[model samples]
Target: METKTKKTLLPVQGKILWDVIILSILSVLCFLLPFAHYTYHRVQWTVSGLQFITGTSVQDGEVVIASQWLLIAFIAAAVLSIVFALVFPKIKKIRLAGFLIILGGILELLFSVLFTMQVQYIMADARNAGTSYAAWLLALIAVITIARGFHILYKNKVLSPLDFMIMPGCIYFLINNYFPLVGIFIAFKRVDYSVGIMNSEWVGFSNFTYLFSSSDAWVMTRNTILYNVAFIILGNLLGIIVGIFLSEVFSKKLQKLYQTTILLPQLISIIIVAYIVFAFLSNEAGLINKGILGEGNEINFYNTKIYWPFILTFVNLWKGLGYNSIIYLSAIVSIDKSLYEAAYVDGANRWQQITRITVPLLKPSIITLVTMSIGRIFYSDFGLFYQVPMDSGALYSVTQTIDTYVYRSLLQLNNIAMASAASAYQSVVGFVVVLVANGIVRKIDNENAMF
Candidate 1:
């Protein structure tokens, strides 16, 4: 017989020292590497009416300016935090280090912004100068180091083996989700590529105008919110119903068959699903038109917008119900069977048992799922709105949503600033809505609410 050993949690050795070493290396690199380039140029232009035509000009060699020293201050702060972490084992001292790291990160940001402004004012052509990749790496490293200090301060000791297991995922989230948040600045910038992202003039909410100023804004916003609300309500309702029904069936063979059949649709790609929909809905050479409805009174499903609301709702349910139901099914399966047995002994019928026992038990899972869904209410699946309709102009009024609108506008205008602004707006609004929903849930039923 093979024996299985239990794993134990232990603090990682030299974890703090490793972090300090990495921080020290990056800090030194900040001073040694070229922070940003300073370009000098002479411009000669010929006037034609109010327009000026540029002529060829020689570029002066790039200069490494003195502003790089600002990073030295940041490096000093990081080193101080690391030293404190090593020398002082007290909680207050470690916390002080965390505060210092945060202050250093903030100062770094202000310094970089001030440097960009100085570059813009000094030489007109110098505005085109770009910061080196090293500078960006330094900023990212500073933030990570700050976060590390805080984590250490929280635990007041080395991280355990269990913490190490989750470290990779935490780092990935920081890089993929949190780091890209720096690009939110693009939403406020005019974004002249000739002048780099940092050097671009701040337009202050001008990019947001593109989204709300259009005549179709109201229609798109309304459709997006309404469809999401319907999806949340209907999806949860049907999922719960099917899950409960499945749990009631005692046969193993029939239950597996039903589960597999329902889940198969979720595994299929949306593009393939669109083609299947096209086969049934297409006016010309369609299964419905030629085979079922026959020749005379064929419906053009693609062109007509009225039928789409129903079609889309049905399609969403068909594709999503299987996956959504699995959550409720798992919860239901874990419920104590003794409760149902006791209810039966009390002469409770199936409907009464479900109402009194099953529904009440499922409350926590339902509230959690709904709260998460609310966070993404402003977002829509792009392929559903764009590809499923076959890009029909007539159907756009009903099918158009925030995701599709941003995609189309991105292609048409090729303005990244506008797209960034739209995305930032969606994220902010969704965050606020989720917070409000969670707050209401907490007040109504504190035990079932998600914190």
Candidate 2:
């Protein structure tokens, strides 16, 4: 006798079919519920169904009232979505359509809970006595439903394979990084903490009034631009020269030792090194005083703001040059030795070789480093400005950049929202600078332009 066989399905293969079946059941249960509902209240004239939908309190003898209209609306949306998805599962656009429906359901459920409490609080205000929120509840239902629809549309999307890999990262960024990014709006607002993040009324660019449409704007702007310009040009130049010289000067036996010596300061935190600098620069019992100069009363370096630009640049070079040089070292070492040997055989001097072979060969590394560094031009190292200065008021004039200004403001205001806004502003300005710099590079040398 022949027997008919039943096919077995795997987990994923069975899930869609099961979802469709469950959705059918849920849709039937949900669609049958009444759209309008009523509640009873106490501590006042006994209230019943106030309108098409009502909001009230059902406290003690007074029963709390809630319509759950938004909840019903979401359930209705979800039910309609299941039916729609059952009809069209393969269409790409339906993915977005279906997501919007689920989003609406979620938002409606959320706001329904929120508004329930709000309306109850307003009505139950013993201060209001017999005041009722019946009309307000009806209006809330309409507003919430519409808000849910807009929010749903905003939340919908189509995910691809790449998005699957990046979705978790994207979520992390949205919460940790992007949400803080919204603080840029504060830069344009006369922001205060009273109204909180969203409900604050707009101020029509009053906050930026401090930055643009002023004269001191040019001072800060010029200082930021020129300081970074000097650092990039001077930093890379010194780093490359040092890297090449060290690569040549050290014997193979001493190479690691010499590299480590150059790199040792870099391994230590900048804050720690700033203290070391303090020891050297201390006005009393300092090594520079007792050991070197032996001068009486010593120089109060902190009070002299005129000397800071040079001192800060020097410190930056000492701490950062080795690391930057190491990057150039990788490029230097990878250069073809045959070119150097041929030049040597042709009687090329070391200086000539550097001019012809080294500089030209290092162009790619130069452009890459310059491009990356340019992206940070509008920003400054926080530790250098804050810790190195020991937060002295004396150095505030020359040392204050956009970052330091923000830090000082936050310290004074203790408002995290404004801090976030300042950070967002720095990022945007830095990004703009990089793009403009890249455009200039592309015009000058397309091959070396980043992107």
Over 4 Å off, model 1: 1-26, 33-59, 63-89, 92-168
Question: Compared with the true structure, what per-residue lDDT tens digits does model 2 show for residues 363-429?
Answer: 9899989999999898777787778877788877777777776776678867544455556667878
TM-score of 2: 0.65
CA shift of 70, model 2, Å: 15
Query: Looking at model 1, which ten-residue stretch has the lowest summed lDDT?
Result: 46-55
Among all candidates shown, the one with the greatest lDDT: 1
**Runs with alpha carbons beyond 4 Å of true place in candidate 2:** 1-179, 212-219, 295-297, 415-424
- Report how far residue 378 has shifted in candidate 1, in Å: 0.9
- Write model 1 residue lDDT over 214-326, tens digit each, in one string: 76677777888999999999999999999999998899999999999889889999999889899999888889999999999899899888999898888888999999888
Indicate the residue-level lDDT of 11 in model 1: 26
The C-alpha RMSD of each candidate to the native structure, in angstroms, is 9.2, 10.1
The lDDT of each candidate is: 0.73, 0.63
